[model samples]
Target chain A: MVKEQIKPMTSRERVLAGLRREPVDRTPVCNPTSVATVELMDLVDAHFPEANRNPEMMARLAATGYTEIGFDSIMPVFSIIQESSALGCKMQWEQKDNWPTVRMREPIWRDVEDVVIPNDFLTHPDTACVIECIKILKKEYGDDVAIIGKTMGPWTLGYHCFGVEPFLLMSLDDPGKTKLALERMKEATIQFGMAQIEAGADALTVPDHATGDLVSGEYYDRYLKDMHAEFVDLLPVPLILHICGRTVDRMNSIAETGIAAFHFDSKNKPQESMDIIEDRISLVGNINNPETLYAKGPDAVRDEVCANLDAGVHMVGPECAIPLQTAIENLTAIPNAVKEWHSRRESH
Target chain B: MADLQDISNEKIRQEIEEFVENPDEIERNIETFARVRPLMQEIAAALIEGDDGTVDALTKQALEDKIDALEIMDDGLIAAMGVVGIKFRDNYIFVPEVLACARAMKAGMAYIEPILSASGVEPLATVIMGMVKGDLHDIGKNLCIMMLRGSGFNVVDLGVDTSDDEFIDAVEEHSAPILGMSALLTTTMPNMGKTIEAFIDADMRDDVKIMVGGAPVTQEFADDMGADAYGKDALECVAVAKGFLSVQA
Candidate 1:
């Protein structure tokens, strides 16, 4: 145990440093998805819907997360709708600063046979903006700040293209159809993932909704188990898997995914989840974003962060993308908590 | 050994037949603290077989037989689900099977709810549930609704991406005693508190209890927001809601 003195580093260095398993001066506070706020929308003039898709505006607004809150990284893309938009789902582009949502009433694919990964999918503006944002961040910060990119998993793509109710029903009635859908969508996952890796993204977050509500751990094994393992093989950089809900059920399988880490939810106990992962991969978070970061103040954020830090996650962050209205002080408290934890550990 | 084995076999056969013919009776007995493990296995099979009509018929019989809904949830279905949930917790079962059981439970509930509603079973309390603004994640919110309903509360689900004004409107519309707010994203979680503040501004905070849950929430944070309760999962939400409603009584 060669303990060394720690110092402040840039967000890019802090994140990349952690990925490499090197000692970081302090924990990096970065979300691989947008932490866009309504305040940022007014500041950068890059509101949602477009901020979710446009490169320049997206970068400008995302930068606020880094500039204003002192997070180690900036994420441009706001929602998982991009992959579905490319996959041909009917989209409702809401107001500026609002993420576009897929209209489930109008599913693009009624059946698995209708699913296809378009050849020019990566070149789509929604996809291209992410790449452009990465480039903009790289050029602007020049290795000072980490640029996080995001891609949708095949399951999330399945939700957008096939619709939530339809997709769940297909999985129930015809397992074969569900497999077929996930398989065809795998190419989209790979294509977008590779493009982001090629761009200046320090890491990429793959958020799939393998929740306890809609599906079981068996579904993760039947579908996502191997697919996630394949993602570890395909992507060149560190990959983080973010799933919503009480995913303690799938923790063991998720630990086996061979990705760099798993970003978990607060519904999961930090100590219990830690015991499950057991150092198989770096753990990112289980912060109570709604109750702590969103509803409460910075002091509450600090309390939750210390709990996760004490539980031994590799990084500390909001459990997921933060609410648009979360106060800046609350977001900054994550890093502050990390720093306080480090100091406390040293004194002990 | 042979005599014990023969007796066990006879018991099992009789239990299986009863489970197949009278699942509702088994559920009702379970409410009275009678063990329904064998019957639960039978119901699980019926569910996996997708015998919707059989499940419906059995559910109706259970209501007729006076099976306590909450007891059925705890002793029969959720108990079976506990098996699935444990396997899921262990990675032995995956998303598909869990979803299947959830569907089966939902199917059973659909049959049971109308009966429970008609029985004029007064809810322990009325809870208005919703997701706050700038968030579309409802899976957690939906789970809490099921647990709240199962625990004997009448829940008014306002659905996802709800604004402060909408929550205020629901509180007035339903005249509910408790409010449960949920958000999956850190970004939307604070809106839960702001929504609470809105209630305060409208002078409606005194009349209602506020409970918050989701992937991003914490109890300490709930306290900071002046929320009455904080639930970690859907099951916990039921316990918390029950506690609050009981306190009021």
Candidate 2:
């Protein structure tokens, strides 16, 4: 059978096409998570603690994903703690080489009734920087590349707001209250997602840490499935859901969420994840960040990239955020391998 | 095959039937379950189901019913956690389920600990556990602590973001023979190695066995850092602790 040859797409077009499950010239290297590293930060003089706060530095560091590494998408929101920081959780804004984290020991809210999205939530420096950064990327790239924005899901917000032990314990001790808390917290997700969309983000990465290691597939169905479907309807842009660890157990439920795609972790096999999604939604990744991208060389990175391509992953990127110390060569090899694999496929 | 009716306890029989209906491919430590008495099996089944209230009640009833504290621990809590460990490793269950099981195990342990300690019977081993410096994630370490305690080890938990000196001081204070470190981020994984180097510099390298685990840790990384062992999950953490104890013996 003769397959039709498609024309190459612009970075924005390529990523959108891949998300829509349409044909592309090659697989788009889309990192819905951060690819910012210590080396890249030094290259652009945009380090964390500041990049996390300043829009100019955030956009500059994120642009390296496209300009330096040749990925089709640029993700500016590096830390998951931005929304939490704005919500009043104590944040440890680490050095250039470290990831900023929320101090879970100091939880801000005790009950679902206490959950309140401050009037200044959108105008907060940390949250506003993401919107402003997306605006800057749109000005510079202007439809040439896809600018991806992130909004922490309610489950992640629960971790930041109530602390991990208290939240999980609440989920186990009293599911009704947990649902109410997630229901109330979801408003924050929708507001931030809409703000980024208005700020010119083409897509949104919704990272809810219902990681397979921490939460069960049943919990995904019970708590998050409806909310995720709601996000697709409420948010204007395409939504990519990201979860870490072996999530094959919940892939079936995730497929029914009406999301545009799922950014999977390396703990899951690429072929298995592809099969589970069954083309219902695009699968963006299953790359090993710690092993292949951080510890091993480019050759190992190429092998994983090829594996995802062969598995028919809609886009290729790291499993989660790449380690801050990950080499530039390993990050560059992702797009290079995608191009080479497409060329080889075409030749055959 | 044993008859379901002949198994005596309905809950234990139901649990076995459930496993029989959908069997896991991983080889379980069935010897522990097989050696458990019928009452202990019921306790084990409740623990596996994560019925903490039931575990708490059953453990108390067993103690009052004249069951040996050590017998109830080995035959009930530890045995149940063994099934959970394999289920988790093989992906039959996940973190929420495991946490439930660990909580139930703790419910059972609360009644057993004081009794076992008062009898002057030695613990399986004294171990120190913590999250490496700069890493705040401790869910994995907490799970390991639960499993270690269930398996009869006395663990000194140093909590999250523990510095090298904190780890060294914990081991010294407890006079612990084993140390287990956890880190969720690759950025902080080197802290495990740094903690090991600190031990060496303090001339305490040979005094304690070091083990490392977490999402980012691999056997190769553990070996590179000169760790005595690497556990892939909470169940493996218990096994590694036992291996250290056997070597010391």
Candidate 3:
């Protein structure tokens, strides 16, 4: 544990301990989501949308989170559409300047009966790319740092496969049908998550995307709370639940989830989120992605890091994927702030 | 006697509050609807209920009964949409609910658009809106368009991956005074500045007011690009466009 450390801790040990809500030498500098940037891609010669499909480029690019940005964890999966791609959702593999997104306009499945997990779901290029990247990172940096992996939760999968408008309409119009579709779709989340763990991920970021923009807190409790609790039970390793937007309304329900940590957004204040969660789960993230990391300088980034540290947030990083154009100085500011924070306290 | 006297007011309160959860929004909506005629109030209620077919039928009925088109537009469609916008901003509802309300408002507007055009009733303002180049996310842009059209702005959508030249030409063609840019990616946000630069190069920057928005956009970034205003979301975009026109007027 960090409080009684006789020797210095490894990045991976610090992160795992933080997830367990155990003592840490300091708050771990980590992001369970994408920290990929256009500059980082240029540094590694690993640009997207190719890097998203190619395992070698993916691993190389992900390693920079450690070697370059000084994050305690390396997350290879940047976009949320890998498993959706494997599941045969229409894809728009955008240029290097844009994120590759699911062609949500062209939905694949409509009815609960139409939900199908392919027999070769794990072997398809997109899903398999993630697995291969994890294997490479584990072989290389597994001992040194945590290789975080991503798997789309069923609610997000429902959006990708069923289209956003149609899926939400289904949820609103027919509760039973929507629940059945989510039930049928959850296997894909589990299979892909397990495959990455088998390939040696120390933790998994299961991005459910029960976004606060569309879904209500009541809907989150009604639809995803039990499912997320089940995911914690099924996925053996440490689990992180990521939901975007102003999700403070669902914090109580989220705390009910047996997840190891909640990868929260910057919209929620860190101290308030810690109060709501009250040690039910570890908290990760909440540095503003758009303004602070992408547009502002290192000083702004440092201020955000210090706020999360002050709030006793377990891990600190960008609220979501860093915009591909984020400056290296802003990305590097994270760990530097954490180190400075600990040293300043010790001096006091 | 007091209880009986407040009965009608209380009913209107409960009815509007049924759709609107926020207290401030309900009071504002109640005040806006108070002067509206009963037939127009019926139309507003249907629009707020997201009953597109009912809005369609009732709007057509109001038209046949020789009610003024602008009155229906303002008291019925626009007033209800104001409530929808407030509810959305307050998290009382979200994208799907707003989409439904926009659809209902559209149904009512369909009957009014032809009449308004024939009578030469001017739009609030002509605003040009588009997603910046390389940013394909359209949910935010489409939502803004819906709210703009509902709020009586004549919006010319330039669609996703909009080039600076496209923006420049649209302004010249439409003689539009307001230009709005949206980008959902950080990599593409700089393109907002680039488009503004294109306007400057074309010597048309002063002719049109510029507003920028999306998930990743901010007021500081908008200021950096020398934009006239920045909106955080769809409803706010309507307010920004209105502000631009109000300033122009």
Candidate 4:
């Protein structure tokens, strides 16, 4: 079958079109999560702890996804602990080579009533940095590329504020209380999401860590599906829900959420994930980070990019946050392979 | 699902029969629960359902009824977890479900441990487990600990972000012959090899059998790290520990 000739899209048009499941010249190489590596940080002189807390540095480091690696989108929220930091969880700001994490053992909230979005939640330095980074990227890139901002979903915040064990135990011990806790915590997500949108984010990745390894699909249905749908209505920009690990079980429910897309994990086969979502929501993902990108070479990376394209994944990128030391060549290979795949398809 | 309160032995056996769609897949020793006394089967069912209260209360009742603690543990709690492990490995359940089952197993173990210890029988074997240094993720390690304990191994859970010194100290302190290390990040994964090298430097490499696991760990990575075995999940963690114990025996 001969394919019609297609025109090339600007990064912004390509990414937004892919998210909307609209036809694009080719699949956009997008990382809704962090593509910030120690190498990228060094190149930009914007290492973490500072890159995570300073807007200019954050933007500089994040810009490499577009500038250096050539992904269609630049995502600045490199760490998931921003809202948690703003909301009072103690932050373990690690060195340049490590991703910062919330110190969950020192949980800040004990119950639903204690789930407070601090007075300066959005204005807090860490959270503010994300918004400021988005603003900077928007001013700099404008319509040339899609600037994707991230807001932590409440389930993930529950782990940060309440402690992973305490929050999970609460969910198992009392589903009703877990529901109420997530309901209250979701305000932080909305508040942060709206701030990013106001700062000129074209899309927001609502990363709820209902990871397939840790939480059941049934738990997702009970706690997060409705909340995510509410996020679509509440957050102004295109919403891409990112959940890590094998998530095919919840793809149907995730598809029904009316979100713009789901950034999937490498554990899920791209074709099977496509068959499950069935174009209900566009899929953006799922190149293996640890094995393929972090450990292997560009050839292995291309193989995954081809797999995602073959499966009709709407966009293609690393599964989650790429490791801090991931090779530059391996990272760049994503967009290169996507373009090559498109060119080959057109030639056929 | 049948009402959890319907705790009769026959009903519990029927529940196990129902919960375990493929009985043949369970270990041969665990499959013997099918022929055990009804109360034991009921205990197994409560544990499988993750009803810690039911498992705890029924375990005490089984003790009061003079059932052997070992019999209760082997045929009841461990048997139930055997099914839970298979279900988890097969993707019929997930972390939350496995965690719930582990909690129930712990509750039943709380009643069984003292009696088993008093009976003067040595633990099945001693194993030390921890998440490698710089990696704080322990959900996988904790799950393996729970499954190891449930499967009759005395597990020394060194917890998350454990350094090589901590691992060596725990092994030396506990005199554990088997060591299990877990890491969730590729960056911290090399620390497992570092820990093994530390063991070699300390001249304790042959003193313990080493197993490695976590989301990012592959058999190739395990071999590269000089680990004796690599478990893909909590179930495989238990199986590897069992294999280590059998080899030592």
- Please report how far candidate 2 places residue A29 from its true position, in Å: 1.0
Report the poorest 10 consecutive residues by lDDT, candidate 1 chain A: A1-10
CA lDDT of each prediction against the hidden true structure: 0.73, 0.88, 0.87, 0.87
Reference-based lDDT, residue A258, model 3: 84
How many clashes in candidate 1?
29
Could you tell which candidate, 1 or 4, scores higher by DockQ?
4
Off by over 4 Å in 1: A1-11, A25-27, A90-100, A104-106, A212-215, A267-280, A297-300, A303-312, A337-348, B1-50, B56-249
| Candidate 4 deviant stretches above 4 angstroms | A1-5, B1-8, B21-23, B26-31, B247-249
Query: Which numbered prediction scores highest in DockQ against the true structure?
Result: 2
Error of 4 at B129 (Å): 1.0
Ranking of candidates on DockQ, top first: 2, 3, 4, 1
Lowest summed lDDT across 10 adjacent residues in model 4 chain A is found at A1-10
Candidates 1 and 2 compared: the better one by TM-score is 2
Docking class of 4: medium
Q: lDDT per residue, candidate 4, A77-196, as tens digits?
A: 987989999998887787787778777778899988898788899899989989988999999996799999999999999989988878898898899989999988999999999999
Shift in Å, residue B233, candidate 1: 6.2
> Per-candidate interface C-alpha RMSD?
4.1, 1.6, 1.9, 1.6
RMSD of model 4 against the true structure: 3.3
Worst 10 residues of 3 chain A by lDDT: A1-10
**A18: Cα error in model 3, Å:** 1.2
CA deviation > 4 Å runs, candidate 2: A1-5, B1-7, B20-39, B64-68, B247-249
Best by lDDT: 2
Per-residue lDDT for A251-279 in model 3, tens only? 88998988999999998999999999988
Candidate with maximal TM-score: 4
